[model samples]
Target chain A: MTTPLVSIDNLTVAFPIGRKLFGPPPMVKAVKNVSLSIPKGSFVGLVGESGSGKTTLGRAILQAAPITDGKITYDDGERRYDIASLSKDKLRDFRSQAQLIFQDPYAALSPRMTVRDIIAEPLEVMGLTKTREETDARVREIAAKCRINLEHLRRYPHAFSGGQRQRISIARTLAAGPKFVVADECVAALDVSIQADILNLLKQLQRDLDLTYLFISHDLSVVAHVCDYVAVMYLGEIVEEGPTREIFANPQHDYTKALLAAIPSLDPDQRSRVVSFERGTVTVDG
Target chain B: MSLLSVENLSIRFKTDEGLITTVENVSFDIQEGEVLGLVGESGSGKSVTAKAIMQLNGRNTVYDPASKITLHGGPDIDILSLKRERDMLPIRGGQISMIFQEPMASFAPAITVGKQMVEQLQIHTTMSKAQAKELSIEMLDRVGITEPARRFDQYVFEFSGGMRQRAMIAMALTTKPRLLIADEPTTALDVTIQRQVIDLMKELIGDFGMSILFITHDLGVIAQTADRVAVMYLGRIMEQGAVRDVLRTPAHAYTRGLLNALPNLDNLDAPLTPIPGDIPSPLERPSGCVFHTRNPELAPGSRYETEIPPMSEIRPGHFAALFPEDVQ
Candidate 1:
């Protein structure tokens, strides 16, 4: 088998819950023993509810979260690094190859920065380009790839709509030319109509750039459309991982089944007929 | 007779940029025991339409002079005509109640859940303080809150997100209002909590025979709970019909775009066909059909750009603004 672009082995992220003064501080165990892999150029989706640790798992893979145990390796076909055990130099190199697209576009971008500045910051911070002309060329090229209007790049983020801001967010992420990207609920905040436009753009860019995506979202409907392979996370563990069609057609886990059954559809009268598993129920299968 | 009738209603916001027209000549009805789902994307004016009925918009909101909002079997008061706060009170909570997207904003943090309920009930009804307290507790139990009396004394913060929504619903339903305007009430909730809330609302609707003007951007939620679905865009009704008809056989291009954009559980790998171009700013309202700019079927320099498409009945009880292609 080809070496996967990203690999994980028994990754766990634990956050101290109580204050230091409290007796025997307990860990929240946000992510517990999650293991997964993403092949090169595959659009992979990580889906779960609010406390399911899907977001934490994504951050852990990026080494943004404190990995309490286990190993995550990133190989971009050029250089390899143990994400959790990287030196400062290796970390700086890794930054050029791995990037994250935030869920809330409003809070992610600096309001004070112009769209050009926002997109150029990553390239400037990484020192990928030395001259002003080089930086402008890269920013405009990536901005066009993300389908942003070139004229709008001079305006502040507040001037653009949600969809436009998202394009800027995508441009910034892609400006780094990362081999692997984690787009965390990137379209959840946009309108349904606008959401489709963004999703389609992301798909087109993925093909053009041969980029591997780790799309994190609570919306099953979105994941169903964008992802080829999906991993259903629950309480910090992946309960089911399979091809998107197989999982959606015949979801093995009860939680996955419920999540599928819960999407409010265009058909106003289509209610959930399946029995939902209540909290504290013991699972018969993984 | 319908429980509520909204006719020729239009709303515009007085932004610094100018009067940005949001919702245009929109009209619909809510039956005594029916759920009317207003489905649209951001700037579709679904929320604005619902809010117009409640007169909930700020001072800068301009309701068109020709707007007529009548409540049947209500207090015989014209909702739009009621100018004074005292005049709007009986209609606001007594006959009609509203639930919001965020429950926390509507709920008070300093007061106990029961105290707020009792106070709301006292102000609406002629019940004594003790009587209101007892009734409010029973209402909480009715909404399936475990240990109603014990939970009543807890502050809004004590309740979880789901529990807080349930409490909000309990408070809204206490007055036994005839109409309920739920504006994306489950948008912020998890799938599981959203399911629970939908189930609870269905039960309440059946029991009380109350009409619900359900507003949400999620087509799936509207499909599950609403009897009739109205698709709105740029402050106008794009289409309206039975949920089954509108969703399964959407006639309007905007409605089709919304359904197509929705990720289907059946086809996980199919790329979402999002409508191209962002929703036009309210300030630059379209000249003809509001959706023409984004409609794929639109021909350049077509009549749609020059002439407004009037809403025409396409089938029995199904209405949509027809394009040139739709006529023949």
Candidate 2:
């Protein structure tokens, strides 16, 4: 079998809660012992409800989260990186290959920065280009690739609409020449019509740039729409993982079935609400 | 007779830029014990129309003289004619209660949930403090909140997202109002939690015999919950009909565009077709059909560009912004 572009092994992310004076503190295990893999250039989706650690796992792959245990390996057919164990110099090298697209576009970009400056900042921070002309050329190229209006590059982010701002966000992410992108609920904040535009843009960029995506979202229908493979998380564990079609067609886990049954169908006669949510009797949130 | 009737409703807000009309000549009726969904994208003025029923808009809001909103419940009350906030008291909580997209926005973080619920009951109902507290606890339990009595003493920040929403629902329904204006009540919730809330609302509607003016950008939610539907674009109602008619066979171009934009679960292979062009800014209002700019079937600079079509009957109970001959 071909080596996957990114692979994980027994990843566990825990945050210590109550502190102890003499002993260890109690912990909340956000991501339990789990493993996932992304094939090269595949749009892999990570879907789960809030507090399910889907976001934490996405951050862990980029070494943005504190890893209590396990390993994450990133290999792009050129250089290999054991993300959690990389040295400072090696981590700086790996940073250029991995980037995160935030969930809220409104909060992601700096309000005062011009569109050109925002996109160019990443390329400059990574020192990808030496000269001013080279950086300007790269920014314009990415703006066109992301379908942003090249003429409006001098305006601030406040001047653009939500869809236009998202295009700017995409341009900034890809400017650093990343091999893998973690799109964390990138379209959740936009309207459905605008959401389709962004999703289509992401699909096109993936094909054109040869990029692998870890699309993290709570919306499953969207996952089934764009993802090649999907892994469903519940309470810090992977309950199901397979091809998008197979998982949607025959969801084995009760939790996965419950989730799929919850999406309201567009057809009036086919509201098959087969699964019902019963609040956790064991829940102890005081 | 319908429980509430909104006719020729138009609303404008006084802004620094100038007077801008957000809702234009929209009309609909909410029958007793039925859900009427106002479906649209952002800036569609669905929420503004609902707010106008309770006279909840800010002081800068200007309601057109031609606009009329009437409540047909015991003595017919002209909603638009009420001049004072105190006069709106009976209609605000006693006749109509509203829930919003974010429960946090509606809830007071400083107060206990139970205290707020009891206060609402005190203002709206004749029940004493002891009676109100008991009833509030009962409502919390009814909405499926566990340990309702204990949770009632907790502040809004203590409860989880789903629980907070349920708490808000309990507070809204505590008055036993005739109408519930749910403005994207479940949009912030997860799918499973959203399903629970929708089910709860359906169950409550059955138990209380209430009418709902449900506003949302989601067609799927409307398909599941609404008995009747009105499709809004820009500031106008492009189409209105029975839920089955509108969803199965939409007559308007904007309605078709919205349905096409959603990712269909059955056919995963078909590419998503977003409505072309951005939604026009409120400052640059289109002259005729507001949706004509993004409309795919019709051509720009045509007669329809300047001629605003009326909502003519397409079928027995279906109406669209096109004449009978225009229906394809």
lDDT of 2 at A245: 98
Please give the lDDT score at residue A228 for candidate 1: 85
The lDDT of model 1 is: 0.87
**lDDT of the candidates, in the order given:** 0.87, 0.91
Error of 1 at B96 (Å): 0.3
DockQ of 1: 0.69
Compose the digit string of candidate 2's lDDT tens values, residues A155-237: 99988778889999999999998989999999998888889899999999999999999999999989999999999998888
Over B146-170, each residue of candidate 2 has an lDDT whose tens digit, in order, gives 9999998999999988899999989
- Give per-residue CA lDDT, model 1, range B1-328, as digits (tens): 7888889898889989989888888988888899999988788888878877788888999989998899987355678988988988988988899999998888888989999999999899999999998988898899899999999999988887888899999999999999999999999999878988998999998898898999998888888898898998888899999989888888898888888887776655566788888877777788988888988988799887878787888778889988546843
Q: Which ten residues in a row have the lowest lDDT in candidate 2 chain B?
A: B299-308
lDDT of 2 at A151: 96
